[model samples]
Every structure is written in structure tokens, then in C-alpha cells.
Target: MGCEAPATVGKLVAVNTSGSYLWEVPLETEKPSGGFGCAPAAIPAAIYGTPAVEVEEGLVYVGSYNGKIYAINSSSGALRWVYPREGNLQPVVGGAVVALGRVYIGSSSGTLYALDAVTGDKEWEFQTGDKIWSTST
Candidate 1:
């Protein structure tokens, strides 16, 4: 998967230490951006931020400008689940944080969401009244 940020669709890649690919998964947006013709971003990202890899859980979590989050199998490219299986949220520009079986992330809508790591269910949410761009390191 190319890490270059795309306005519409991007990809998440798992590479070995030797710079070889282990797996690649596509990242898509539910809403299209106006800037669709530009080249990919130089930084490593699915669309806006770096993807979160949870090795112990065998899952890779990524957010898109389409306001959606996806959980993919770490070893395989199979998609495990997606958040807001129906509607959409503000664009998710930050990476996810996985701890204590919860996936925490922020969206452009000025809210933070804590989702069930396994099922992508909304566990809770907090409104900050401002866009959140930073991710936990």
C-alpha cells in the first residue's frame, strides 16, 4: 500500500524491516474531496494521518477524510470492520489509539470517540468544540 495521502482513496501498507511489503489494504472515503487531481502526499498516511497498528490484537486501524474508521487484519488484508456503518462523521484526521480494548480517535467535527476495538461500536464520545488534529504518539 502506498502511504502517500490521497484525497479520495489511499492505502495502508505493512512493510518489513528489509523494506518489503507484508500486507497492503485500501482506504476509501465516503465523501469526495475537491482536491482530487493532486499528487499523493509525501508523508506516510492513509489519507490524513498515520495508521495505528495493534499487533497484539492483530488489527490495523485507520481513519479517512471521509469521516470513517476501519479495522483491518494485521496479517491479512481482510477488513474486519468499519465505524458508522450507516452515516458518517466529520473527517477523521488523526490516527487511532488502542488501549484497554478501546480505540480512541478524534474527528474534524470537534469530537473524540472511543470505540470498541473488536466490534467498531461506539462506546463513548466527547465534544471539544474544535477540530482535533494530533494523535497520541
Candidate 2:
């Protein structure tokens, strides 16, 4: 799936599984900024689920099947930080939540993690009987 900003002259983001990529399209130019607009950099492993929580400034948080969560710059599609999964589980399907200077999301292994929103550093994690399929704040 793909999503574009609400026509306020910002970037558009599209995710596909074929190449594990994130593609960006400038609204005015219609020029594709391939692979999250990082030309020389490696493509993302696989973007899953829509990005959640466009936080302060240009920061946006998204989860991936690469078993990690990424904080990306909204306008430029640049990588700000990466939070890798520590447990033996993937971090897709369940979306992420941002609140009170932290990001919250669940893993497929029935665990939920709270991290510093800016740094991608783990603050805490709580495990539940069933996996957290969704979240809100």
C-alpha cells in the first residue's frame, strides 16, 4: 500500500514487497524518488503497514518486516533512526503508537515495546498473552 500527504506540498510514500523498497514521489514533480529517495544507499528490506505517527518536525515512525522500526524524515524520506527487534520475532502487522516522547508498538512474539521517540532507544517492553494487533494514543 501507499500514502500521500494531504496535498500540502509534501512527499508521497509507496511501499512494495518485490524489492523490499520504499518509493517516494514528489507531488508537484511526479518524479519518483526511488527507494526512499536515497540514491546510493541500500533499499529497505521490506516496508509493511502504513507509517504511523508523524511526530514532531518531519519525523515519522514505521514498522517493517526487517524486524525493525524506523524513524524517517517526512519531507526527505531520510533515515533518522532504527530500532531492531531483540526477540525472535518480527515487528510487522501491528502498528506503532507515539505518545509522551516515546513510541509504542507490539511484536509478533506477544511483546510490546516502548522506545524513545527521537532516538529509537528502548525504554521498556511489556509482554502479553496474545500479540498486540493494534494500538492508539
Q: What is the C-alpha local distance difference test score of each model?
A: 0.76, 0.60
Q: Tell me the TM-score of each prediction against the true structure.
A: 0.78, 0.61
Which tens-of-lDDT digit does each residue in 8-121 have in candidate 2?
233346454574446563322222223242223323334435677564656878765445677877666777787763432453455777788888888666788898988888
Worst 10 residues of 2 by lDDT: 26-35
- Model 1 bad stretches (over 4 Å): 1-9, 29-31, 34-46
> What is the clash tally of candidate 2?
0
Please give the RMSD to the true structure for each candidate, in Å: 4.5, 10.9
The prediction achieving the highest TM-score against the true structure is 1
Tens-digit lDDT track of model 1 for 1-137? 43443333466667789988788776563335432323542222236667788888899888877778899998887899999897777777778889999999998778999999999999999998888987854
Model 2 has an lDDT value of: 0.60
What C-alpha lDDT, on a 0 to 100 scale, does residue 123 get in candidate 2?
95
- TM-score, cand. 2 vs. native: 0.61
